[model samples]
Target: MSSTNRASSDDEFIVVREILSRLGDKWSVRVIHEAAGEPIRFTDLKRKIERSTPISSRVLTRTLKQLERDGLVTRRVYPVVPPRVEYRLTELGQQFLHHAQEIMGWTMEHQTAFETARREFEAQTTEQ
Candidate 1:
């Protein structure tokens, strides 16, 4: 078996690497952003994102836990029928949103390039 790795100076790469390692996670940023508007029940969060397409429950739970562990999200549990859990963004999480929004804004500015690449990728796959 073969392995690949990336190497760079700690001072040169740590910050960007750390940011990507967290935000680059599949549902981390999305789940956090979804919780930004208000505190949302666990089920509500799952449903909201799944409206576009279903995400595995395991993945959603895992992402929420990571966000919470990183001090970027807050989770509240209620005692009642069937139990209730709510999630909201911590101040740090809101700060993270600023970075996310900047990336999104850049994507919007170059959306044409994204579309072109997607079409090219699709064309290459179909040809094979």
Candidate 2:
């Protein structure tokens, strides 16, 4: 790890946690993945993400803004009928997808073990 990443403190750890927490939301990941291929209008994105999480307009706005501020997404506004707004991934966001895919692969590979562990854990708790 780099010196900066190696520096240890509760606050620094919090920063790392914050970064992941923002992307860890179901809506955020779904939004990013859905919009990855091309720029998606606000309503289109709202529909796609809401299909999975029922995200409120207010919350979606906040999530998109957070992603934009984090340099993961770019929002563009167009002048037209009622105006048009679209969002797409930035290079860093595109790169992050690779890590996400790796996580997916790991989950798939260990799914059986994960289920077994969960069952064992629940059984042990019940026995207590």
Candidate 3:
């Protein structure tokens, strides 16, 4: 193991934590994933995102706003009879998705290990 990994300064650690806290957010990462490729309308995104895990419309709106503020997503509005709005991933957001995809893949691959560990832990605790 690298010494730097173990010995990052307090300030550096906090910075890393903040970055992870944002990127690791439940809605943000999924929102970015859904926004990838083509621009998505709010209603479509809401439907698509909830196909697996349900997210509140309120939380989804808040997540999108946060992402826009962070420069990770772009919000485009159109003038029409009814206002049309779409969200797309910014360049930075695409780059983030590449990393996020890797992490997600790794987690999927290792999930069985996690389940096994949890079962073992529970067994040990029950015996104790």
TM-score of each: 0.72, 0.79, 0.76
Q: lDDT score of model 2?
A: 0.83
Error of model 3, residue 5, in angstroms = 17
Clashes of each: 0, 0, 0
| Residue 117 in model 1: lDDT | 99
Give the TM-score comparing model 1 with the true structure, all chains together: 0.72
Q: For candidate 3, report its TM-score.
A: 0.76
Q: Counting only residues 3 or more apart in sequence or on different chains, how many pairs clash (N, Cα, C under 3 Å) in candidate 3? A: 0
Which parts of model 3 have CA positions greater than 4 angstroms off?
1-15, 126-128
Give the candidate order by descending TM-score: 2, 3, 1
Q: Write the per-residue lDDT of candidate 1 for residues 15-127, one digit (tens) a residue.
A: 66766777677788788778897899988999999988689989899988988987889999899888889999999899998889898789899999999999999999999
- lDDT (10s digit) by residue, model 2, range 1-128: 66665766666888778778855676677767877888999899889876766878888898889889988899999988899999999998887766777877899999999999999999999999
Model 1 has an lDDT value of 0.85
Model 1 pairs in collision:
none
Using TM-score as the measure, which candidate wins?
A: 2
